[model samples]
Target: MSLQWTIIATFLYAEIAFVLLLTLPIASPARWNKFFKSKFLAYISGQASIYFVVLIGVLILCLLDAIREMQKYSNIESTDHQHLDAEMQGNMRLFRAQRNFYISGIALFLLVVIRRLIQMICELAGLYAQSEANFRQAQSATVAAKTLLEKQGAGDEVAKKDIEDLRGQILLLEKELAKEKKDKEAVKSQAESLNREYDRLTEEHSKLQKKITIAGGDKKDN
Candidate 1:
């Protein structure tokens, strides 16, 4: 109740609040759900550390100020030193401080969350590979099935014709696959080349536009 004790209490509570802020929004099932893997959370942890360090720097300054105040009044032995008490009371608990820290920590988490989202995007890249793998497996199975069918009807003219038909179909499939591969490569290459040319032309056009503007301005001034 005395002034000295009140100041001390304020300082003590504020420090406590700061600490609580760092630890809030603790690890939870929902937090884990936010990220698909441990690495994502780990990245967030690193950012949280940075934010804590920064925010903590301010809190530390407050602490140092509290200490400086103590020193300023240290010589005043006869004074009640009640200000220290008020500071202690104000700085002791950190529930309020923790709220802001948690907010910053969550914002930093978004940086890592974006990285995770990118990884999710990269995962889609494997779809093309999986499709190719499936196609190969299916082709292999088809050949196996055709082989079995031919073996069962060996020496029959009708079976020979069926095998030849299957072979022709398989050849067609192989050709189509090759064509698609060629087309994909060609398109990709063309796109890259076109992009390069577009960039160059755009730069040139920008320069030309600047020159035209300058020339027109001179004529108008004349």
Candidate 2:
């Protein structure tokens, strides 16, 4: 093979290796994202568009050349039937042309495939990051809700305790009020009995004074 064909063959092999590595499950999406974002890859990516166009142009030219060679050799082999040596040479050349055609064609196809694979990997990485962020937000919200519920529960317990204390105080006040009523009734009954005794003594003293006056008047007359 010529030096140029040899280089193209090497590039094709490299492309195959890249495809295999890309499809393997050796690295996660995050790791692939990191690798793609690295400084070296970033620098390469800056010029990747230009590089891709140039490489495609080269491949197309090589494919065209291979096709022309294949047609030329096929014609020669068919027309020059009497010259066996020339026919053999043409056959060999045609075989090389066909080989080059397959190589360039496959390389071009793989190039596009690799680009698409990279894009898919990038999109997958973005989705993974977004999902992780959403999961973290959900966890934080759950924690916050739990904390709020706990606080409300504590407040409810405090309110219940206060109500119980107020109820106990009310019961004590009612008992005190009942005791005060009993004391007032006892004092009222004692005052009524003292008033009755005073009336009876006054009536007896008046009757005794009237009897003495009558007896003295009779003695004076005798």
Candidate 3:
């Protein structure tokens, strides 16, 4: 049981680190994009933030239960029940870590997460705009490519114009693809940050639950 939590803690930390490092920059450009522009993205982020808040509540309940159980276990055991004592210590550490973490997460959700949500909406909006532009460009390029084919043996002007149009279309697509990739990276970064916050919350929740169990146990014995 102890080892399981240790593993969870380690994994959650790494997840947070990876996400924040990658996503925060691309969407940072307020001029390039404006957040809250995409209602869908904003809504999704809001839902996620709320989910975390609910999770924190559940953790509190579980924590109470664990503390209660611990009380009984601690009192009923023999003097050598050092195992219970040690486990109790471990549980305490988990609880403190979680309490601190979730508190921080709540702050972040208010500030960073909400901000990120806006950024995501903006990014999506930008991508949509870019896509429409690309479609128009592609249609124009297709017409050029067709005109050139119709006058296959025509002057250099016809051949050159066709080639130029095609080249422009390809370049435009490349730029669009690149922009799309950047947005994906930005999304990844946001996910990573959220994941970190999630881990912290989960750990804290678990710790509180253990305490609640222990506390309940103490009550029962008395």
- Give the top-scoring candidate (lDDT): 2
Model 1: per-residue lDDT, tens digit, 68-113?
5445444343455568766454344233233333433443444345
Q: What TM-score does model 1 achieve against the real structure? A: 0.26
Q: What is the lDDT of residue 84 in candidate 1?
A: 76
Candidate 3, which segments miss by more than 4 Å at Cα? 1-154
Sorted by lDDT, highest first, which candidate order results?
2, 3, 1
lDDT of each candidate versus the true structure: 0.60, 0.92, 0.64
Which ten contiguous residues of candidate 1 have the minimum total lDDT?
Answer: 92-101
Arranged by TM-score, best first: 2, 3, 1
Candidate 2 residues lying further than 4 Å off, grouped into runs, are: 197-222
lDDT of 2 at 38: 98
Residue range 11-42, candidate 2, lDDT tens digits: 99999999999899989988999999999999
| Tens-digit lDDT string for candidate 3 (1-222) | 355344434544654664564356755434434443357755776686687677556445544544555554445443454586686775675565554455334444444554565556577667888888999999999999999876775766787899999999999999999999999999999999999999999999999999999999999999
User: Which 10-residue window of candidate 2 scores lowest in summed lDDT?
Assistant: 77-86
